[model samples]
Target: MTVKDLRIELTSRVVMAQILPFGLLILILFGLAISPDLVVVGDARRPVIEEIAPGLFWLTVLLSALMALGRAFALEADDGNLDALRMAGLDPAGVFLGKALAVTVQLVAVETVLGFGAFVVFGAPVARPGLLAATVLLATVGITLAGTLYAALAAGLRVRDTLVPLLVLPVLAPVLLGATQASRDALFADPGVPGWSWAGLLAVFSLLYLGVGMLAFGPLLEES
Candidate 1:
């Protein structure tokens, strides 16, 4: 089931269209908006690009995740395949896992590109390689799971485009906060606390959403 979902999502042009170019656009926009300024001290000059790359990277992920999830289910709804799946006796939990897995894969790809953009465009260095990698993993999982769940909730709505963002962004606040802070700590030296702690919080968020989706998806699909 997961493999089928992966194949469908990987082959979708929409995924490629949104993942790289859109993310690069966001990175460039952020760079233009937040250009580093020169500050002089004791005849020495430095370019100060504040610790904002992390937040901007996460923001790109949030926006892209919304688009990916919307298009994924939109296709299912448009083709009437969602109902067909429900009647086809596949476990709703499996379906949810498949969708979540696909979204996670797309998001990870976007995040990788965004991470590189942050490095080259924003000058955010990898201060803690291991911690940074873990933060990326946990944060992506949390965002993807939460996005997938709300996407299902708004799957049948007429104005789902607007409704899904409303439902998703608010719930994603904790994820954005944790991911941004963790990324910042990982991209800079001596952040005062271990980034792994924030990764743990993100892990909790992912588990909570995963459990909810597994329990609610079956009933949600039936009612939708």
Candidate 2:
């Protein structure tokens, strides 16, 4: 199921044509707004944009993932594919995992592009590569698990395109927060932020949503 969904996503023009460009555009807009050249005349040695690059990077990923989430289920909801899947007697839990994993894969690719943009445009350095990698892995899992679940719930709704952000973004506050904090610590080597602890929070968030999605997806699939 995972491979099937991934193949669909990879083949879709929307994934290649829309999501990546949108993410890069967001990164460029953020760079313009923050003005990488602008620096504070205070004790802080880094420019304001550089200091907040981690948060900006994650925010870009979150917004891009919103589009990816919408696309993930939009395909299934169209052309009676949802009905076909239900009739095929596939395990709902397997379907859920497949879809979530596909979204995660897309997000990881999105993050890599944006990460490079942040590196060059914001001059953000990776002081601790290990912590940054851990944060990215955990946060991506959490975002996709919760997002795929919410996408399933909103699947059959006409307003799902607009409704998904309303439903999932709020629930992802912890992920955005924890990811930003951990990424900042990893990038800057901040002594006070406890990067690993925030990564731990991301792990817990991912696991919590993983169980919820597995148990609830079957019912949601039927209703949608």
Q: Estimate each model's TM-score.
A: 0.90, 0.92
Candidate 2 stretches greater than 4 Å from native: 36-44, 190-193
lDDT of 2 by residue, 118-199 (tens): 7777766678899999999999999999999998888977999889999999999999999998998898776666889999
Which regions of candidate 1 fall more than 4 Å away from where they truly are? 36-48
Question: Which residue pairs clash within candidate 1?
Answer: none
Error of 1 at 43 (Å): 18
Winning model by TM-score: 2
TM match of model 2 to true structure: 0.92
- Whole-model lDDT per candidate: 0.79, 0.86
lDDT of 2: 0.86
> Largest lDDT belongs to which candidate?
2
